[model samples]
Target: MAKVSIVDVAKAAEVSVSTVSLVLRKKGHISQATTDRVHQAMAELGYVYNQSAANLRSQKSNVIGLLFDRLESDFSIKILKCLIRELEKQGFIAMVKTGALTADALTLAVNELKTQHVAGIILVAAGSVDGGLTPVLSAAELPYQVMANQGGLGMSDLIVCDHYSDSLTLTRFLLDLGHVSTVLFGGELHDPVFGERANGYLEAYRERGIPARKAHIIYADTDLTGQRQRLEAALRSDNSISALLCHSPAAAMIGAQSVLKLGYGVGKDFILSQQKYVTCFQEVDRLSDGVMDLSYILLPLEEMAHHAVRQLLQRLDTPEPLPGRAFSGALIR
Candidate 1:
């Protein structure tokens, strides 16, 4: 049987071979009707791009796949935006997909990106998602890196921000401020980042000669109402703790509302904050206003994104696997 080629596809679709190539590569602007006609012609001809076969024949794809659970958090937004920008700067296209935090949902996203023939994948598993996703990702047999989320998942590389170290620094700073006790106000316990931050908080207390108190490490629901209730309850249960180490910006907002509801000022009795980016303050600072004397960390989102893109491209050339790396955040008052 004669194999179908781009020329045959163009002839069958009554379009130029360039048009067929453009449609196949998902490049340039092709009308939907024409694209459909070209696809129909290809289907009639049983045509496939043969990506794996082509890769073996000395060709490299300049596309990067970026997968994420969701894009609601400031951290997710910042990281994705920077990554895409950096990818474009280095002459690579970014294909981004997002879905629910479940393993199946993540698998679907990975599979869809796979269909696009992305050269490498940057899985931005931000937020409180943790679970069995490494298998599907590793099975893809493509160089992939996971950012900001971990679960013993197998991948080519892992990149993360140092949540534990930074959280420990923040906690120690709170202790230095004459606050005898501080509470890790709110976060999901299952998230790897949250767990690290929580550990840092405990370590800070332990190193300060204060015995670890179970009450200091409290986890809260992600919802605003649930967090507000938790904050109110925590405040009532112990007012001696003068500060909160919120793992999220939403949690900080809730804590602020709870403090106000109890007729107490922000800086006078309690302080709250989590993280932010200096270049894009509006997105991070929106939740900080009315929260009183908030001290947030400056996450180098742009720097992280640039490094991830650069590393992924280099790995594509060398195909050498590297160990996971964590970047640290700077404190911003």
Candidate 2:
């Protein structure tokens, strides 16, 4: 069988070849209905758009590069799926690269994406790394965006959830429930993301004129066993601690289990709250059913993904540096 061509697709869609070309290039003011018809025609005719040939002619490709320092969390995975889906709807594809967060590794990754002629790049959670990408990405001269928790580069457009504000809200909710001695659990002490959240928790206490106890803020170890030990010890030593504000779902789970093991009723004898990606909240709810009373802040993972895609596309069109965007999460009881 012969390979299907754009002309065949144009004929089948009952549109001119130039219209089909415009649709393929994602340019011109094409109607949604007509675009759908052209896509259907291409699918029926098994016509594959030759992105390489198009790139050679236009010197650009409708490919967005996604760089990740790490992609290990449920939050990262869910946001990644959302980004890919939204990008595809706008007639673009994602090329993802994940590796160590070293400066050399990041520079190499940016260089590789540039070689692929990707229209733009999105750096997800890469700001956590020590050496920032401002110089590397600026030198590459490509339109790029950063989706991170904290500390963005100077040159890139950043899309971040308001962690400090959300944390303050969550902590205030717990305080309003009359829990004066609340403990903050999990996260690395030195991390900027953790610092913002911890500061928010502190600020809530400051607002209430309650002296925040230094001992109540406990950073979790990387391993579960260590966290369990520390949490159990904290509970045993502090009889006044009646509530916990966990930094993540995992920390909340551990706190709940530790409470139970200590012969305490979760909701009755203690209160537990956590921060969660919207996609993973159901799982946390399921696990905590009848076992713990859980309140949580829902991180705007999907919202951030949608905004990131839109901002990157706009950057591609205009190539002007825009100010960063911050989204706020909601506290759900």
lDDT of 1 by residue, 1-333 (tens): 986788999999999999997887788999999999999998999998744333322324778888877788767888988998887766677888887756677678777877888788888866533436667777877777678743344443567777778877777777776666666766776766778787787888888887676327667764767767776787788766566667666666666666667766666333443112111111246544555456766776787897776666555455557666777777766
Tally clashes: model 1: 0
Which regions of candidate 2 fall more than 4 Å away from where they truly are?
A: 1-59, 101-103, 126-132, 153-156, 268-283
lDDT against the true structure, each candidate:
0.69, 0.73
Per-residue lDDT for 1-333 in model 2, tens only? Answer: 986888899999999999999999999999999999999999999898855335433548878899887788665787789889977866688999996666788789998999999888888883353326567776777777778766554534567767788878877877776677777887877767778888888999999988867328879778889988988898888766777777777877777778767776666334354222111122255435575446677778878888887676555446557677777787667
TM-score of each: 0.66, 0.74
Given candidate 2, what's the lDDT at residue 175?
75
Candidate 2 clash total? 0
